[model samples]
Target chain A: AQSVTQLDSQVPVFEEAPVELRCNYSSSVSVYLFWYVQYPNQGLQLLLKYLSGSTLVKGINGFEAEFNKSQTSFHLRKPSVHISDTAEYFCAVTHMNTGFQKLVFGTGTRLLVSP
Target chain B: DVKVTQSSRYLVKRTGEKVFLECVQDMDHENMFWYRQDPGLGLRLIYFSYDVKMKEKGDIPEGYSVSREKKERFSLILESASTNQTSMYLCASRSGLAGGLYEQYFGPGTRLTVT
Candidate 1:
């Protein structure tokens, strides 16, 4: 079974400060990695995804993530966060060869960005 | 742009009531999914459908069922509402092409509260 793990439950940061949300996954076979952000009372929006090419993936809103094959980790990062970036971020993984896209998601990390 | 829409943004139901959550996608994607989001639990897939009249159970599917009668619509059913079932419900759809972006587009989400 594919599983995703996000170590931090919450991370507090001030405006203009950099932030990193760590994610790790356990899967025997190759998997697709994704980052999603959920704003208050809304659904999740895809941030970035790492499929087969270049491990360094850049996503919307100046967000990016690196897929480390050896470490089995995909970590999201932002050089400088804004107050509007405060939201719950999730890391997800899915089997690469499956026709059905059943994503296994992490528990989530709440990014608390304050001014 | 693909658009996934849920039937309700917020719902209040009493325990034991039968609940129906509907999701529709504008794009003709072949895969649809239902997920529930809870604090510290992120999003856990309850069910997914790869085609009409086809459904598959996810990580958690004890009290839930799903329907897909049309190519663009998927419905989730809660047999009997319970307090434990109260949470933000999200619906997502993805393309089934062999090698596509395969990113799931999500709806605005339905916040269901069972009393």
Candidate 2:
């Protein structure tokens, strides 16, 4: 079974401050990683995804993530965050080789960006 | 643009009532999914369909059933609405093979509240 773990439940940051949301996954086979963001009372939107090549993947809203194979981590980061970036972020993974291709999602980390 | 749309943005239902959540995709996607999002639980897949009349149970499918009579539309049915079933229901669609690398397009979501 593939599972994703997000270490933090909530992260508070001021505007223009750097933010990092950590995510780790446990899967025996090759996995595809993804980041999604959801605003309050809204559905989730895709941020970035790491399918195969280029571990360092950049996403919308100036967010990026690095997929570390050995560590089994895909952490999302941004140099500076804006107030509009305040949302719930989720990390998801799906096994590439497994026939059951449903995405396993993390518990989510609420990023609270304030001015 | 690939667009996934849900029939209702917000719904309030009474306990023990039957509930239906509708989702439609405009992109002729072969795969469709239903997920529920809760605080601290993120998104958990309830069901998915790869083709019309084909459905697969996801991690949490005990209280949910799905219908895919058409290629572009998927409907989730809750046999008996319970307070525990109150959460944001998300619909997604993808246009490729099951195990291949493809990002899912999400709908605006239907927030279901069972009181």
In terms of TM-score, which candidate is strongest? 2
List candidate 1 stretches off by more than 4 Å: A97-99, B99-101
lDDT scores of the candidates, listed in order: 0.92, 0.92
**Model 1 chain B weakest 10-residue run by lDDT:** B95-104
- Per-residue lDDT of B64 in model 2: 93
Predicted candidate 1 versus true structure: per-residue lDDT over B1-115, tens digit per residue: 8999999999999999999999999999998999998888988889988889999999899999999999999999999999999999999999878633588899999999999
Candidate 1's displacement at residue B72, Å, is 1.1
**Candidate 1 positional error at A48, Å:** 0.7
**What pairs collide in candidate 2?**
none
RMSD of each: 1.4, 1.2
Q: Per-residue error at A92 for model 1, in Å?
A: 0.6
